[model samples]
Target chain A: MTFDWGFVGEAMPDLLTGLRYTVQATVLGYAVALVVGLLVAIVRRGAPPLVAGTVHWVMEFIRCTPLLVQLFFVFYVLPGVGIELSPLTAGVIGLGLHYAAYTAEVYRSGMEGVPRGQWEATRALSLPAHRVWLAVILPQAIRRVIPALGNYLIAMFKDTPLLFAITVPELLFEANQLGGQYFKYLETMTVVGLLFVVVSVPSAIAIRLLERRYAAV
Target chain B: MNFFVDALPLYLNGARYTLLITVGGCALAFAIAMAVGILGSTRSAALRALASVYVEVFRGVAALVLMFWLFYAMPLLTGYRLEPVFAAILALGLNIGAYGAENVRGAIKAVPRSQYEATVALNLSWTQRMRLVVLPQAWAQMLPTFGNLVIELMKGSAVVSLIAVSDITFVAQQLRTFTGETVLAFAAALVTYFVIAQVFVALMRLAERSANRRLGRIPARPRRRAKPAGAAAKGGAA
Candidate 1:
């Protein structure tokens, strides 16, 4: 019914610690997404017919399912297959793999958007395929998709809370713990929600700016 | 394998709830999104700001967090016990509505200036201008993005499991807990969601064709393949 500044102040340290884990998971997860997504797009592009088509379907499957379910699958289901992962590792891998499907699409578009002439030019110049990919196509593609990639970073940040299911000590997980400990949701959730707003609002605005800037190009 | 046969009824029930929540939430979200979108697109600065705050707040927080707030916090704060299905629908609707509002605004804005000029030249009233002229064209543009939102909304519906909603995901989780067969239960979930997404995409394509047909134009090449470039990240894109 009323605000509690004192409780908020006392809970600040724990939430900040959780925020740290959230950021770490985000950075690590997004790093995995960046590398994995680019690799997927490149492989899918050059893949043999069956492989490419199967990869496409798999990517679609990953994108369509909920991340919360995926996290549960990774953390719970993988153990049945004789794979065990720590909460943080499972969370990061789950987050990374899910967003990778999206970023892979982004990368696929960026790569395809490159002019046909450039690929032909590389061939004409007798550049090796890897050189063409590494030195030519990817640089341009990556540059074009940087903001798209950055938007994923913010998305991954907001999504880290889903890791709470696996007991990862992310921001919302911390808030949930605090609420359970004290039997109060108003203060803990309000603080955590506000923290999310603090981070996400500006980034959303920035993504809009990036979109406008890229539209001009 | 045998477990799946035994769990068939549960999965079916789950699917029903999942489909119901998605349909209900998306219907409400579409109305809310259009209202907020029109508000954001209006000439009045205050109205635009109000709409902006709603979008930012809802869009910024994850759906799971909002669901928690509504389910756990609301009951505590207001002493008004909210049903899990109601909470799930309200949270998912509000959450997706924020992104949908943004996309709606984009589609409305994408209606060319020439179209507005044509409305003015024809002496159409403001309502006629929006309903007759701007909206039809905008609806065509909005479909592809709406398709994405619908898929995302179904995916987001999985979060209702967190609050014990009897959606497909919740049912899967319950079956998993009871049978201790996590792989089968969750794999079924993944495949079910995939099939739903495919069906949604097919439906959107049909709607797009009809919309274009309304304008007396034959539907041509699918624009969906080209849409992800600019429209990525519009609806949580998660």
Candidate 2:
């Protein structure tokens, strides 16, 4: 019925454990998303029509579906086909894959924003294809896309709670369990929300600064 | 396999709830977004800050957390419980309103500054200028982003499953639990989501076409008349 700081203080240790999981899942998941997204973006470029269309459709489909259902599917369904993964592993993969679809679009747009002349100039110099991509194209595209990708990471942070459905002991899950045991949803959930904003807000500001600095060039 | 057949009716029923949440939440969000967008773009610093904080909070927080807060905390605080569907709609509308406000703000700003001055010179008040000059142009700029947000909303509605809303995802989960046909149920949900998202995008394209038709004529007709008259005057004077 009211705020209970004492219960919150008592639960701080367990909450910290959940917080560690939240941070790990978000960081690891984002790392995976970054790599997978790069691959998707690259595959789309210079691919045949069917390959391109299939990639596009698959990415869009992944982007549109809820990560919660995806998490459920990965955790529960894959075992029937003989792929075994822990709940945390499944949750990370789900989050990473879901956001990878979005990040690929960001990468594609960033790559497109690179002037066509840049590619032509590279070819005219007789530079190796790999060299062109690594030296010129990727640096520019990745720099341009850092802010959007950072925002997605922040989103991934907030989304870590969905892992709770599969029994991953993240912040919200910990808070809910604490609440159910002690009947103090107000303090626990409020702290969880504040903690989320605490991490996300600064990261967002950093992303904005990065966007401004790069965009000016 | 039998699970798929037996749970067909429930999934179909669940699909209706899913549709309702998506459509209902999106429609409500669109209205809220427009209002918030208008308010945010008003030349008042205080109002702008208020809207900014609101958008940041909703957009920054996960939709599931917002839903949990609304469905769980709202009832506790208010002593009046909203039904799961209403809570889902409310949480979703508010969340999308936050992001949609940004799109609206960007779209409104993308309209040339001269347009606002034209409205001002015509002695239109602030509200009238916004309604007549700003909104129509903003709507055009807003369509594609709005389409994307609609898809986001449809996917977001899946979070309602957490609060025990009997949407397709929830039904699928139930079927999976009951029948162990986890893959089939999930694949069906995924495909259903994909089809529904694509349909929303397609409808947005149709809306964009009609909107372009309306806006496309506004500029061309005036240009046509002005150019011919100028040529006629130049010829006669020579």
Measured by TM-score, the strongest candidate is 1
Q: Per-residue lDDT for B200 in model 2?
A: 79
B1-238: candidate 1 lDDT, tens digit per residue: 6987898888888888899889988987898899999889888999999999998998888888888898887777898978888888898899888888888888899999999999999999988998998888898888877878888888888888877778788888887888888888888888787787778878988897898888788856655554432134332432
In candidate 2, the second chain superimposes onto the true chain B with a TM-score of 0.87
lDDT of 2 by residue, A1-217 (tens): 6677798899999999999989989988998899998898898896888998799778867876777889998898877789988888998899888878877877887898899999999989999978998999999988887777777777788789899899999888998898778877777777787787677767777777877877776
lDDT of 1 at A28: 92
DockQ of 2: 0.31
Model 2 global lDDT (CA atoms, 0 to 1): 0.79
User: Who wins the lDDT comparison?
Assistant: 1
Q: Which stretches of candidate 1 lie over 4 Å from their true place?
A: A212-217, B222-238
Measured against the true structure, the TM-scores of the candidates, in listed sequence, are 0.95, 0.92
Candidate 1 CAPRI assessment class: medium
Interface RMSD (Å), every candidate: 3.2, 16.2
Per-residue accuracy of model 1 over A1-217 as CA lDDT, tens digit each:
7667788898899999999999999999999998899889988999898999898878878887888889999999777788888899999999999888888988988898799999999999999989999999999888778777778888888889888888999898889988889877888898888899999989878887887787665
